[model samples]
Target: MNAFKSKTEFAQTSVFKLPHSFLNFDNFVSVMTRAHLDRAYWNTLLIIVAAVIGNVALGTMVAYVLGRFEFRLKKLIMGTYIALSFVPMITTQVATFTVVKNLHLYNTLWAAIVLNLGTSVLQLFIYLQFLRNIPRELDEAAMMEGASLFRIYRTIIFPLLTPATATIIIIKTINIYNDMFTPYLYMPAQKLTVVSTSLMNFSSERSTEWEMMSAAILMIMVPIIVLYLFFQKYVFAGIVNGAVK
Candidate 1:
């Protein structure tokens, strides 16, 4: 309702009078044109594609190794991941920022992509769970057919992991779309703004354009809501399959 309302009317209208507020599309037009949301949308799409691909590849490889092969340091490596997950991200910002600067990733879209590339512990566990259900007989049969480990993974394992991959893609896309801190902190260039930060056009330290902000919020929300509604079954299936055995 506020998205269609004039600023003055939005500010003065009573909560009970919301249904009677004037409908105006000026807020939507202003946010879309003046706020430069188009560029942010494209930038976010690039980051999401890169980040999700990296995550799926890296997570699958790690899960393949840990699930299929026996290694001396396997427990230690997993323990490290679990331990690090407990550390609050805010507590490590200084070190993380310095590393990003050292690698010269700061202020670039690569910074967001690289930072988000690594698989989280939860992702690792989910992938591992799926790997566990895959039969060793399949690997053995592939090996008998002169298939290398890489071939087995690419043609055999990857195809079977599609459900889990879909779940991860949906979840990761939503996360990257909604994330503001990474882009705001590392990529401060006005041209690098993402959808999460584009709403700042309606905000100032002194006061905010509530009507425009409402419209912007709606714009930002629709994609994620639609995405989840379409793919929610995969998410539930992945979680249940990963947890059951």
Candidate 2:
């Protein structure tokens, strides 16, 4: 019951060393300095933007088609998508490399982006579900005004899909940012490494650099954590809006 007592009694562990440790600061300066974390930061950033925007845009378009338009074998298609959702990415890991190799995407950052965009099955479903709740009257009115399908999507539905869009972007931002396996598997070049992949390398190289690794981990995670902390309200709204309706 004594919150202050709990706070006062808390002790810093000896194992948890400070980031700017005097013991190791001078050693990593040489190797770390040459590598230049800034370059990696920019690279990671470029990959994230490419991955997130591509997935969201494509996913949204697919959702709109599935939601608004009805044709033959629609249920079968939806059912297949749902079934594919259950298949783990690991099941197709072998083929991904072959496909990437055929396109000569290996060791390149673009491979990271392309791989993620194609696998956004869950996102498409979320978009489709949200679009379903939109009134048919909206489309009818837009049609009466001579709005082409692309125009209606560009002008009408897209604006209204903002909540869903924002939600997917935030969530996918975290996913793509922290994703280590894909980049490691698809693009093994240390030069093409992202925050997650770099952290993995740092962790292994500096198995003893717990403090630096911790600092690096925090450095990579902080921005995303802060973003969610501040925008959790809207994030949840978007998720629920799409999930429920």
Top TM-score prediction, candidate number:
1
RMSD after Cα superposition, model 1? 1.5
Q: Encode model 1's per-residue lDDT on 14-39: one tens digit a residue.
A: 63456353556677889989779899
**Clashing residue pairs in candidate 2, if any?**
none
Kindly give the stretch of ten consecutive residues in candidate 1 with the minimal lDDT sum: 14-23
lDDT (Cα, tens digit) per residue for candidate 2, span 124-206? 66677678778889989999999999988888788888877888888888888778898888878767867776666445543
True-structure lDDT of candidate 2? 0.71
Cα TM-score per model: 0.96, 0.83
Which ranges of candidate 1 are over 4 A from the true structure? 19-23
Best by lDDT: 1
| TM-score for predicted model 2 compared with the true structure | 0.83
True lDDT of residue 76, candidate 2: 88
Q: How many residue pairs clash in each candidate?
A: 1, 0
